[model samples]
Target: MPAPRLVPDLVPDLVLDLALTVRHDGKGGIADDLDGVDGLARWVAARGDELAEAGAPLGDFVADEDALTAVRALRQAVRTLFARAVRPAPPSPADAQRLLPGAEALDRLAAAAARVPVAPRLTWPESAAPEITYVPTASGPPADLLLAALARAATLFLASDDRTRLRACHAPRCVRYFLKEHPRQEWCKPSCGNRARVARHHDRHRVESAL
Candidate 1:
């Protein structure tokens, strides 16, 4: 199994989770979680249970190499878009264009949405299982369904109030982004905070030693 996430609670949106597929090492380099099809498959599997609960299961769809490539591209676009959005200044025209969903992407989402099924259920007893449940039969290509789900996540995230709190980690060489839950929260997790503090301490000592 892939290693458990270092900061599980930081992922508030699926789009943000997708963007985190690539992370920075704080040593002036970055790491790619979805390095290839296998890497992508692992990433998807890691979230399989959560997706299933959300009514969007992968169901062997991650085996497609082309789908992996497409997902990677979408992740990069989401990162670029959010990076621009969180900056103090307004995003340039080119950046906005990169952020906007293209016609092809929009068409794919529309087609997939049309085929997606809706399952509703009602619980009879509060403590026991639901007396009546409807499990919708899934339709459409799995790859397309995955793409459409990501597109929807991106759209929903953009419209949410949490967008205002979205932030990229400030630690040296750390490229992870997160939704700021607290006003003072900066780094994505405690480890990043410690790393940043150590880097700062080293910088201060080096400057003092030079003097």
Candidate 2:
């Protein structure tokens, strides 16, 4: 069975989770996931508030030493994020590297993402998807394959021939991504839509008065 995608910003959150490599707590014990291999739990720890805000949570669940070390490093970096944000500083190379790890499964997902060629047509057949496409082998699709498939679809939609249909928010401050409801729709929400309408009215009024 395809592993269910965790509902809370899983793509972004999973990226964070993957960056975390769990290890020992230092007293001496194996981690839940990464053994003593030195993994990304620190990154997850650092994003505590972010996860909290996202209705998810980041916890220090590692029991292994190597994983604990990496998690500590990530926590330190995350701690400085807000302070660093005050300046126009760019992310450090190490921080950028955390977004993708060297895992083969992740590499396969990346390759799949690159090859995604489907258009963003939301047509669903009677069967949403087979509960299982095929039996899982060690080399078969990654556990979170449904999300991987969706991620691939999203990539394809962005790269699609009908690129104009993919819209970024018209309101500069709003950072949400959305698809255009109509060919002319620019704002992502009705509130932003209403704001735009008012702004246009003022511009028109000013032009007429100036004439």
- My TM-score estimates for the predictions, one after another, are 0.69, 0.32
Off by over 4 Å in 2: 1-153, 159-164, 209-211
Candidate 2, residue 77: Cα displacement in angstroms equals 22
lDDT of 1 by residue, 1-211 (tens): 3222212222255677887777764456666878888887887787776555444567867466788877776765666667655888443222344454545444543444344564545545777644432233566676766665665556446555667888777776666777778889977889989989999999999999999
Clashes of each: 2, 14
List model 2 lDDT by residue over 1-211, tens digit each.
3332223233334332432233223443323343333333444456556433322323424435543443344333331331133224333223333332324333444554433222222233586642212111222222123223333322322233333343434442333334455766766678767866787899999999999
Report the CA-based lDDT of candidate 1 relative to the real structure: 0.62
TM-score of 2: 0.32
